[model samples]
Target: MSSSAGTSTQGEPLNATALNRQLKVMQDRINQLEAQLQAGSGAPRAKAGEGTPKERKRVKLSAPREFDGQQAALAGFLIQMQAYLHFYEDQFASEFEKVTYAGTRLVDKALTWFEPILKDYYENGDQATDFTKKVLNSYADFTEALSRVFGEKDEARRAQERLTHLRQTKMHFAATSTTTG
Candidate 1:
């Protein structure tokens, strides 16, 4: 049989080979473009300062979602309690200095209010104790009171942990310096 170039019924050229080659070239070009974009290697350059990226703000680390609602309510309650506790504690301190019993009963009453809140806080799964931070003065007063009245065991443990951490850090730095040198 003789080889002949044939046209289809519609009189159009039936160049299957040419169509396949063109399709393959187009596919290769598309794949190459995709690869470049994926690799971030051949993208269009951005104008300096015009499209310059801003430094991203650091995200605060959050506790597990389970504690979100309880934590917020606990924080508000703590703030309110802290303010009253501080006022009374200060009043008591002043009165004691003057050998007066004024506000003594009020201070005891305040302590009673705080007992359940503290118990629940310690019992919660995540012991995230730093709360009541809305008012700086109040928070500071509360923290001071906590250390004075309630945080003895925690304060001692924290101090000991800090000392150990400092010692370990010093040793690490010294070892690293020796190795590098």
Candidate 2:
């Protein structure tokens, strides 16, 4: 057999024997790693009651004590409503802009009704309990009313009436409570 010379593209003589030795060394290291992995011995083992150096102390977590069930229910209702609105918008993209505008107006009207109750709850500590009750009752009432309105033949008219009733009831309450006190 004739011995052939190996030369790089740059015309420099290449050491084939040295390259083969280096390749063998890398292959051996890879084989050793693979054997260790197969034996489940790649990582250092820690005995019982002698945890690994990188082990962290476990912590227990709990839900917030101040989370109100009623408030959570109300928030869930709002989230459901928002999801329904998004679905509606997707289904009727042609009329979505107008519907969104009307929805914003409705929300603004509702916020106007709610602002006083929130203000009263924040400003007067004594009235907070009463205001909270009012807010929760309003949420429950509105949910029921909305369900009923959606079930009716004239949903738009019924929805408008429901909103009007909510606004008028709160206004009347505010007027009566201020006069009485």
| Predicted model with the maximum TM-score | 2
| lDDT per residue as tens, model 1, 53-124 | 343333333211221123224344345444544444544454222112211222343445445544544475
Q: How accurate locally, in lDDT, is each candidate?
A: 0.44, 0.48
Off by over 4 Å in 2: 1-106, 129-131, 136-181
Candidate 1 achieves a global lDDT of 0.44
- Candidate 2 lDDT by residue in tens digits, 1-181: 1133355555666577755765687799889988987898765555655774346343333211221223324445455554554544444444324233323333333445445545665587565765344443454444443334333457689789998887443534334434554
- What is the model-wide C-alpha lDDT for candidate 2? 0.48
Q: Which stretches of candidate 1 lie over 4 Å from their true place?
A: 1-14, 42-61, 64-181
lDDT accuracy of residue 55 in candidate 2: 69
Tell me how many clashing residue pairs each candidate has.
0, 0
